[model samples]
Target: MSRLNRSRSFLWLAGTVGVTLLGSLIPLTTNNRFYYYDDTQAGAFGIWFEIGTKLSAGEWPLFSDTAWGAGNYAAEGQWGIWNPLVLLIGWLASTSPNIVVFSTVLKITCLCVLAAGTFLLAGSYKARPEWAAIAGVAVTLTGFTVYIDAASWVTGLMVFSLLPLAWFGLRRMAFAGGNPILALVAAYVLITIGYVHGTLMLAVLFLGLFAEAWLTARSRNVMFRLLLAGMVCGFIALAVYLPGVLTAPVTARTGGIANSGFLTPDLTGLATVWVPGSLPQITGWWGGFAPVPLLYVAWFLPVLAIVDYGRMWAGGKELAAIGVFGLLSLGLTLAPSDLGPLRFPIRLMPYVSLALLLGAAVLLSRYRVAVLSRGRLAVTAAIVISGLYLAWSQYPSIRMAAAFGLLSVAGIGGLYFLLFSPRAAPRLKSPAATAAGVILVSLVVAAGQHAAFKASPLPDYRMPDTPQAYSRQLPGAEGGTFVVGDPTKLGSQIWNETLASNAWYLNSAQVQNLYSPIMFAKYAEDLCITSHGWTCSSAGRKLFETDPATGKVLADLLSLDTVQILRDPAATSDDIFRDGPPAGWHESSRSADAVVWMRDRPLLNTGQVVWASDGTRLSLVSENSQEVVLRVDGLDGGSGKAVLSRLAWPGYSAQGASLAAPLRGYLVELDIPANSVGKSITLRFEPPAWPAVVGSIIIAIVVSLGWSLGELVLLRRRRPDKAWADRAMAEPVKAVSPQ
Candidate 1:
């Protein structure tokens, strides 16, 4: 291959490997805990579990009381149905008794799909495979993104990753007219597949799509058809996920609902989590002492893209897409909503970055070297300054700063190619040669990053298995209703919102926790107060749970008090309750982390047991596979463990219990067996051994070294210079060259 052919081929190989590396790192090394931090996980996973159970029994999706029973805060609540795609995965996994393997495999699939989409997206832009691969890796390591994945925020990060690729695919179909309809159909279908987080991505996509259509008015028919196909595909995707979307409101209300006060665009700015304090200082600064930094210096290309596209609005497609994306970032960064939407949207930054980067690349591709020199320097300088500001404000580590420095230099090198050596060597003479080069680069990045990740994994962070594995018993008051709470709190790992407190209350089965909307409202208000450290007194606590309807201050009226709701009524219970000795409670045999009150409340006879379902026969192939509900006859007010050990049956263990008062009963959710009897089942839950920051560093080194080494080999064996250039642009006019 000629020199240019060799360069392109080498870059492609590095990119492929890098892409695979990125894919592996995102799923394999992620924290393997379940159901964390946001309502997204709780909603997605909870629904998945429920759907899986249903599918095993060959039943249609239906909202389950069991899932929503813990929360009394919503007007409507249920896990009736979920996105078909998620449900399908869950169903397939349910076929196996070993959930660990099932979940592991499923996650890997999601990551792989995302990786493929990312590759397609990068390819569509005609980006050097290496750069695209590196970008993918960077996107995966983004702090908020990693956190979301680790916390089981399935839709959060996964859906975000698909959007850009889908967009690229759509662009190719529309502009290039090569099975564009099929691509449009596929992209829309996926978007609507009930990936809850995709909603945000959808918003971004729509904005870009509209901009593209309006800007390219002369080609409006083509754009409109593409849009039409997209909408149709979107509908198809929705149908696939109709169950989940239809029931999401109920789940959100009862599960992870958070009401942001600033609905107006003007006020929405205040709802962002972009305060200087919220930015991750450590990882952002030092990049965990890794060679490459998360904030690459090449990111300046985005700035260049913005400026170059500023006045060049032939139609506004490119400018509009960039503009809308920038506004989105700005809005999200400014708002400080409880949902963390703004701050978390950083997960979507890669798309924005890609837009900027590609725009820069394409623009520079068409420019003369002499003209770009001055602009490139200015652009590079601005990037350095902004990067410094981000680093300083975010409080990143020195290692992180250095990583950015190196990455910045690399970006400058890329720019150097654009300005100084536009035609350093001839293009490839043959397509096969070019393709071979791309493959080589991809392998190198993939192999290198994988090695690095294995060498330095994320630190082991063990999450307590409360509702999932422990505490089968929970009390339900007779004539009293119980409420399941929002389990989304555990995602942040911040003390205030730990789900433990809520789980404990449920498992305790003490006085029936009323479904109090007022409580939710209070929780919201108290959040602000506690954040300010302004509400800590007993009075403050009482005020925090007050009911507007009854003019009743229920905080003191209720017998129960979580550390989160007392003393500093505004403080998250996490502050004082972060992993401590159990206070005023005793352990029980039937539950993991079960605690019984030392001083029991007066009883009006123990609460009566109302309902029980020990997921025993909720599987296929079992002769007695029948869903059954048990009614615990009578017991009121007493708050102690009540075991139905006598009720033990096949396919279940006799380790169920419920708190005494408010009729608490244990549920024995069963895992459907793959066969009548299968091999010894294993459940693995190993977390990474390195911190994310540290892991990121290792990834950087592997990517850089691997890319460098592979480049060296390709350079040495480059084909004749004249022969390569001919192949680089030798594609038939009908063939849609990848981005």
Candidate 2:
């Protein structure tokens, strides 16, 4: 019997890994292994992969002269500088800046983790293996997962794994007893909060869990313990999360949505949460909605939710507390529209999806397995037929509906056979059937999801490694800032811009390319003004097309002297192409892929003493994931301002002159002495942990660690003769034998 249980558990784990991998085949194996549509994948992660190269070189991976609006602000917290996952990937891909490969690996790995975590949590709650495994699928292949997985916003998928792990820990402490795994996982979720949604959604989920603990505590003391656990988690989160929290307000994302109340999610759209590719203007994806009814995706989900809700309310307050938790989470989705702080409303769907699926699984496990009574069979068939009819009626394309209907019937039939029927000489039961049901469901969902995701046409973006590079040099090699332009706007084939820009960077040059990193608000605006003359964008990026005059003015400001445009009409207006190079510049060269122009003199040299008139030279010294350094030479003699090209942050140090405040709000300048002339200077970046600048982060870290350590000690001392973890999780209530 024990061996059978062990086998069942192993199969459940393997089944999860198998299903996640099956779902990932289309995205992973495709030529477009990574989606670079929009900046989230290609341009944004393009910069991140560059930073990973710096990490490989063992440099502090924060500030850069080549990007961040050409020079201003550290490579801010928008892309998760401190996340463990980010750092780990950064470390691994340091020597290899292959964004596509790393992103695919991360996506596949996270999906597996999400499934395994959900399955373990379900088992910890004493769910039947089949139901628990289904819950894992429900969590992994939802609308939210379908949309975000394998996209540029892959970090959000990482949270799917963390959420389940955290829940498992909380459940163990609540229902069984205290254990190390729970606190550890909970702490990890809190730490990773910044990696996804800037900590907003994760924080909201934490609050919901807090409410659950309050309502469901077996005793008041237990409630205190739970609250303390939450406090501990928050403390550590703030310790790590403060820098991002402090800086995010200054970015373009600071403002609240105007008339946010109108952002309510459509009821129909909400119902089809199982579907993917809604109207981009509507559900924000290009594909049509799913063929099946949304609620049909969770057939047993709603049935079991009601059952669980009733059970919790009538007999088990502890279980009922979970019901309330789900309700609160669903309710929080509504607040995003009315409340000012939240951004996208769809962000709340993952939690609501989890609640619905988990509630269903718990009910399925704790109750009697449904018998194939004649009436029940008839009812199930009627429901399935009605669902097919509804699918056909709702979707515009009847063929898709028909196809979905067929799949549904097959899936339902397979599930029924696995759970209820014994084909040969009928025995009391077969546990192996549970594994079979998991496989059936996984196959159907994986196929449907792949089709739904592929329903909309993907952007036609493509780029080969070591992509096209221009053979010409811009005039600003001294200042290391030039402008590059491409014909296509921010659409597919955007890599023309990145490829040329990479050519510039590798050939020891920098560009004001159409690509923008997650930038400072002022820098974003400056680039917008420079690139488009008058167009403004609130998103933290701007295009790089410019009116002739605007181009010159922007060049002056950004310390640029050369402008290269790929031979394309949209980027090059006839004004300059019909005549020649604009005033103050002359055409230097032209080629099929590029045209280069030159300015007579340099812009503000990176290491200008007195902000000008000094024959000073600055060269990049060494850079890696942890730090960046620049060498300044031949300051011929002066107690003048030494202006550097890198942006000014609070965390800069220099070898020759004392580090002073920023010259403007954008560039870094230092006060040096006349005697410092002819002596080489090295400037380095080392930003302080701003969130804990006053030692609060340290204090919080110490207190939280101490509190957690104390709790562990107390638990051990109290249960000296027994292993609490073994009792709490390892000995999860065994599945009840069929009567």
Candidate 3:
């Protein structure tokens, strides 16, 4: 290819990737909170927010050695295990809270990395501008992009957005027999730091890489080295991964009770990952935004890319795409979330899908001739299969099915003749024919999938509109205590102190027995004897009543120190405050939710003041505001009752009752008290942990200096003879490293 052509191709790639990234960022940035059941995505955002909060407080977000099932969503004082890279990014952005700006910057950075990587990968296939752009769009618009709920997951999504770039490098390394070891290390490390689910994805990538390398390497040592590099990265990734995995068994057990057959399907439900309509409730118009058509069509792209797959394989790229897609697909279908567990495959699928599509694009570009005809046929078949599956899944919504079914059929018919049997001389193998085929296939697939992709509606629910909203409204009272009516109670009174609102907390009459640990521990013997009613003890009542009482019981409950609550917009004065405090004294705070007066305030009547020294008579010494002295007759003999007036808080030596000092060293003594000798007391000191703080700052400085030094070395070492054009083309064609 000419230099002009290459430059144009690069420009086209830049434009396409830029546009796709911008589009993806739009929805992510706009939605302050997004609606989705994918907790992994939500967890990513939560991790970032927590890290941001921690960094703002001048602390590193360290891994806490603890796990609590119930308070996972409760932001403050929740479980604290975070991916380091994610913590680093959020910490970097802690200086500002304008999430939009932070997210935009990160998203752009991810895109630049992606584009550079793609350019390198595509250069291997000598892909044209148009073909490369198609690949870019396909990746940008895929279902994975939806994971970016801008408010919480900007960093995770940004990290995820770099997968294609990494894969591109992987491909180059394999083809050129270059030192891919470093690239492998960097890629795995970044993924590990980027998200918790990265382990699963990394697993798939490793498996794929191993398979690809073994099949292509000329020597046993090369294969061993590749596997060794992967093993090293795996060990490093495990540093963060082991903790997340440890918490999973507990998380699954706690979440298992919400397992509705419809909501949490068994083997049948697992199939829905591939088939669109199996879960119609999650269908586009219902709640799912991943259009049935789009997912279906995407699956077919790899099949169409088979022609290019042949060419790439012949050229030594190794046929890894098929193996990758197949492995991920199998895992998704078999991985259990509730049965035994929602295993690693659940996390692996999203990234695996990206590799699948990228491989397809590479193949499509290589066999441009076959892509026009055979590619269309394969895509058409895929659309048909997807449409059928979607319609089957939504069997009740037959009218909806009919509409999509007809369109899918007609699409296949139109594309079939264009490839297998053309109207005039069948301009097969011609550039124009092939180009036209590519255009038609791309349009049809995109349009078909777009039709289905538009299904996930913006959830109308907001804070207070749903149960999840309750956590958001909790606020801290003056003393850092907040009362909230638990939303789980059925027919229970909802006394939302914040906005003073009421809803049936949980309909208790409908739910007779509360299945809580407090109930089980306290009343288990009695309930077994009488076989009875809702016999809730004081602890059980605390466990059960939020606003209303929900029927089900929680095995474990983690209490919050502070909470903010939102009042229902429709609420009036009559809603929440009707019922007086239930068996407890009520004291209201200036703040709405600050009401506190439990009948049994445990610490009410129990404290004593004692003298630190036994003294007979005492004299006082007045010093600066930071010091004081007490004089006693017993100072010489050490045995007399010297009364010291206004003594300082116990720890310091009280000059008299009115004075004290915090320093431990000796001071000037006052005489006159005998009984004041040997009475012990307590004192308070407020010293900063300076050594630890200074050490952290020093480490930051060292890292910054090292990065600068490394950059200088890399710049000096860059290949001198390589031209802009040669570097641009060659960078993407050979295996590269972070150094």
Two-way lDDT contest, 2 vs 3, winner: 2
* lDDT-superior candidate, 1 or 2: 2
* Residue-level lDDT tens digits of model 3 in 1-739: 4677567656766666665555444443334333221222223333454466557767554421111111122111122233345566656644434433554556556655554555455454445444455555545444434432222234345555555555555554444433444355346445445354544455566677677666665557556545644554555444433433333432212233222222222333332332322233222223432223223223234235235334454674455544664567555523454334332233343454455555555555445343245544576466456545644664446654555455445543544445345463556534335434444444443344444443233232122323333332323222112233322232223324322111111111112121111111222332221111122222223432432121211111112122222222343565332333443334333233233333323211101111223334433333222233344434454543221111112122333333323111111112233354443322211112323323433443354345335535665665322243334342332211111
The candidate maximizing lDDT is 2
Off by over 4 Å in 3: 1-6, 22-47, 63-85, 88-129, 144-159, 173-189, 244-317, 338-347, 367-393, 396-476, 479-540, 543-585, 589-739
Better of 1 and 2 by TM-score: 2
Candidate 1 regions exceeding 4 Å error are 1-18, 26-46, 69-82, 95-108, 122-138, 149-151, 176-197, 230-351, 357-375, 393-400, 403-407, 410-739
lDDT of 3: 0.38
lDDT tens readout by residue for model 1, 1-739? 4677556655554554445444444434433332243333224433455456567778755322222223221111122132346567656634444434454455545555555455445444454344444444434433334433533445545566566566665565455543343354345445544443455556666676677556654486567656655555544444333333332332222344343432212221111111111123222222422222222212333334223343345422544554676567445533333352222333444444445444443333222133444555676566555555554445455654454445444544544453345474444313333334333332333333333333222222232333343234333322112222222222323222223222232233332322211122233233222211223333323323544432333322232322222222234655322223243322221212222222123222211111222322211111111123232232232222222211111112211222222111122222323231222212111112213323433443354345335535665565223232223222122221111
lDDT of 2 by residue, 1-739 (tens): 2566566577767876787677656544443544433333434444445556566667655555555442322324434454455666655643444545655666778777777777777676556666767787667666556544335455556665677767666656644556535555455544543443424544554555556556655467566656766665565566454553455543443556454433345554454443322221132334344322222234343233113234344544445534655676666655545343345554556667777777666666665344555555676666555544544445555666556556555665655665567673243244446545555554565565555544213232444443123222343344434443443444434344334322233334555442433345565454442321112221111222342422324344355665554443443243233335656667776645555566676554333332432454545566532244545555554454555545554455777767666544555666665665456566666545643532544554565567657768887557532333232223433543332
Model 3, position 374, has a per-residue lDDT of: 52
Error of 1 at 247 (Å): 9.2
Q: Name the lDDT value of residue 708 in candidate 1.
A: 36
C-alpha RMSD (angstroms) for model 2: 6.5
State, as a TM-score between 0 and 1, how close model 2 is to the true structure: 0.75
> How many clashes in each structure?
90, 12, 87
| Model 1, C-alpha of 345: deviation from truth (Å) | 5.7
